[model samples]
Target: MADSADPSDTSKAGRAGERLAGAVKKAAGSVVGNDALRAEGELQSEKADATKEAQRAEAQAEQKREEAEAEARAEELRVERERLAAEDTRQEREERAEADRQTEAQRAEAETARKQESVSQATRAREQETRRDEVEAVRERGEAETRVRDEEARAEQARGAARTLEKVEEEQR
Candidate 1:
């Protein structure tokens, strides 16, 4: 893993050194009248330039590799985040569904309780009505018995008054 900075710095430095060496060789060749040495120096400079270009290419390739790795890492992080978010959403939905189920159960329980209460109320009402009917029937029977006794007493009193009137009439005669 190479640090992603200026990859051309080393190549530029190498190029500068090569240029300086070529210039010195050219100057020495003019002073000593040596063509072969000057030609050799030019070839050496070309070789140095080629080496610099190769280094520059290698550095560029390294930089591109680092960029690619960084991109891959970022993509991986993005995918992981998405996965976590989906998991959270799923959990939330599950929780909501559970809550809804609990609510429905509670509602059903409340309805059942209400129905039971209604049935109890109805039973109590029926019992109260039955008791009232029994009381009314007893009162009616007592009233009928009292009426019968009063009628018998009246008939006996009428008969006794008639007998006394008949005896008084006979004594007067």
Candidate 2:
């Protein structure tokens, strides 16, 4: 029977045997009609049972407390993991936002450069057109001056010819 009995059960049986022995001793003293001894034996049995029950209740309470602590630790770890994950997500979002901002800035800069280039090209074109107009004006003025000089020289030559003819008739007469 000892070989078959679990250690915890054996310990409980040993405590029970001790309680039984005390009760038997009190009962034997009461057999001669000693009422006090019988009453004392019953009281002792009640006390022993009460003590055992109290011990059992204490063990159960301790076990429950340990289980509660384990559960609390698991919950805390879960919350921490969630917090870390949220932080990572927030960081990722911030990085993406920063990248978007950079891209927008670059695009705006490129647009501004393109506009400036167009404006510069237009300014150059205007300057070239103005120079061409000035050259044309100068050429037209030179052509007009040449025409006026040629007309004056022709008139002087005709006057000289008429004067020579009048002198020659007068000499001949």
Best by TM-score: 2
List candidate 1 stretches off by more than 4 Å.
1-17, 30-33, 90-173
* TM match of model 1 to true structure: 0.35
Tens-digit lDDT track for model 2 on 1-173? 12223332333444444345446545544544777776775665555455455545564565567557655765665565555556667778566556655765576567557755765675576456445534543454355446545766787888899899999999999
TM-score of each: 0.35, 0.40
Candidate 2 lands at a TM-score of: 0.40
Compute the lDDT of residue 158 as modeled in candidate 2: 89
Misplaced by over 4 Å in model 2 are 1-14, 90-173
The local distance difference test score of each candidate is 0.58, 0.56
Cα deviation at 116, candidate 2, in Å, is: 79
State the local distance difference test value for candidate 2.
Answer: 0.56
